[model samples]
Target: MDANEQETDREIVPERLFQSDSNTCASVCGAEQTIRKDFLDMLRERHDIERHTRWYDIKKKFESDPRYRIVDSLYREEYFEDYLHIMKEEKRKERELREQRERERHRERKADRRDRDKDKEKDKDKEKSRKDRGRSRSRDKDRERKSSKEKEKPKEEKGKSEKIKKRETPEEGEHREESDKEERAGSVDSEVARQRENEAEQKQKEREKKLRAEQSIREREKEVQRTLAGHLRDRDKEREHHMREECIGHFTALLTDLVRTPDFTWKEVKRQLRKDHRWELIETLDREDRERKFNEHIDNLMKKKRERFREMLDEISTLQLTSTWKEIRKLIKEDPRYLKYNSDKGEREFRDYIKDKTMTAKTSLRELLQECKFITHKSSDLIKENPNHLKEIQDILKNDKRYLVLDHMEDERNTIVLGFLEELNKRGPPPPPTASESTRRNK
Candidate 1:
């Protein structure tokens, strides 16, 4: 910064030292002139020095000078009211003392007048009471004189009343007039001050009432705005939900159409087609509803699996007696209905179904042994003629089991037949204990 700017920054000006529109330099400079620092300092010293002075002393200072006159009203408001109250109290005391002195002087004057009247009454009694001359004539003359005095008494009293009216002192009357004027002025000033205070209080109350009303209006407006925003939000959410539901209905129709299509006989393959078409549409549902619908769709996908199993059961009895299980399996898969049951879960379900269906058809182990013994009843040389006898028995069992069976992921139901045959081979053919032994036993 430049030096001039720095100097401008450092120079200080204190506020509230003088009122703006004071008439101190009205003709010479301007009413807007600021008080000099020296005058401010002088005022500060004068305030400390004269703070204890009489109110009239400060009033004289204010009334004589134009400069102090402006500050005088401010000073009276700020500090002079206490002194004003004290001066009024002192004036009251002085006036009361002056009235007391006047009352004492009046009392003394009345006492002196009373003493002089009593002395004139004693002298008149001394001069006229002792001698009695020409009693009857004196009595008549005294009566006539008394009548004349009574006739003149009213005029003399009127003259004395006029003299007393003229004797009222001008100084005392002026004092009473001045006192009355001061009393009237004091009452008017007090009334004016009281009215101004009441007006100010009423204005403040109005301002506070207006503020409360405005605040209440603002709060109500904010509440209405929040309520409106909430309603809009709810509307938006409902719109979104409606859109989602419409999309769901459309996707469900597409799935149904895919199931009705003629190609791909397996329900699983049909579902796969539907998935390829609208898989993204199904992802928007909530968790519980989504899982429920997904399971229902899966049921639809595997719908043909049980029908295919029942068909396999019906075909089991018609298979050739010489055919192996692999040959039977090959024939079964060739059917259009078998494709849906080819999946892992479908195949497992089919196997369990077969197990349940064959439960009633299962041959007892004792009955099966007896049947094997009967089949091999002829001789040890029966092997060459019946090389595939175990296969024959297996085909018979396939018929008994209703053909819907699986073992080791293959049609290995014939292994049970082979087990029975191996048991028959280990035990040599039972000897021909025929009729000769029977006859000897009978003798």
Candidate 2:
């Protein structure tokens, strides 16, 4: 090969190698992030890791866990903090969503009530209009009858006068009688027509009134049925709630401390529970529900034992927060609470108790800083602009008993104070005045 071709080939090889290396680095980074996420998810599943949990406590608890080894030890603490932040955010969102749904339901119910009231008013107005029309029709029928009666009286008077004249003149009387007969025939036809029209109108009014009555009856029946169904649903829910509570109470009574050991099996507990008469109270519950309640009772017992052990630790005045598990094991080995678990388990609990205390101390110190009136949104910038401002704020905080909790951890205290000031600054200015308030101010 020529020297120029050889050099070109060498250059191409290095470019390919560089591209492959970049791809490999990208893949490695992606895999690392995936495992790190899995480790955080594992920590979330651990019910023992509470809001008060510390990195030291969690590390010892899950050091041997497969998922824990996925992430490097350096990143575990950072991931745990992320997990805590995610939980807090999720809880806040859930609370806000629940409140918003409640408000919407309240508004919907109010609107439904207003619509019902409006419908009732409209129905009352229609009924009143129908009654008024009926009254006016009856008045017109009375006036017609009065006018017909007056016209009949005038015809009768004319007939009397004509009869008297007929006795005097026979030919004239015959002619007058013929004309009266024609007039009477026409009056009879008119009266019959008026009677038929009145009958038809009365029948139409009666049919309409009957139809209205039937419709009202049907509507009432529907309303009654809806109310009855709602009552039945509420009753059923109440009964279910009461029965669930009774079942839980029965389980709590049956599962005593002696029966709910770490090695306790569901089979043995079921056999023992069935023999007792109190089991009848919870017999209606499904098998899965019964087992779940049984497991919950056992967990409660374990939690109470852990609390009692922590209480024992708190009562010991000689032990320091920084004491090692080996040192703590020697101090509480003879205690009954300590003996409740194995040596390793007891050490884990001691570590958790110490972390809990540290978390509580840090929380107290933060609260003290928040309550300090001298601290403001601009406090962080002010401290930077004037160094002595930091000391002055610290001296003010020193007077409070809560500040003494983290008095030895100067760096942590300063970090918390600065972090809080930064948070306040991030909040920006207060909200604008509401429209109603603005209107009131103008007035």
Model 1 residue pairs with clashes: none
Worst 10 residues of 1 by lDDT: 31-40
For model 1, what is the error of residue 107's alpha carbon versus the real structure, in angstroms, after optimal superposition?
A: 91
Residue 359, candidate 1: alpha-carbon lDDT: 51
Most accurate candidate by TM-score: 2
Write one digit per residue (lDDT tens) for candidate 1, span 63-175: 55444555535444344554445556767899999999999999999999999999999888766664444566789999999999999998996787567558868776578
Runs off by more than 4 Å, candidate 2? 1-187, 257-268, 286-292, 315-317, 358-443
Over 1-443, each residue of candidate 2 has an lDDT whose tens digit, in order, gives 99999999999999999999999999999998899789878888898776656676357778788988877778889999989888778888999999999999999999999999999999999999999999999999999999999989989988997778867687877887899899999999999999999999999999999999999999999999999999999999999998788677667767762375645778877887788776777788778887887788778778888888989998888776567888777888899888889977887888888888888888988888777777777887888899999889888888886776676677987898889888977875445679658878889
Give the 10-residue window scoring lowest on summed lDDT in candidate 2: 254-263
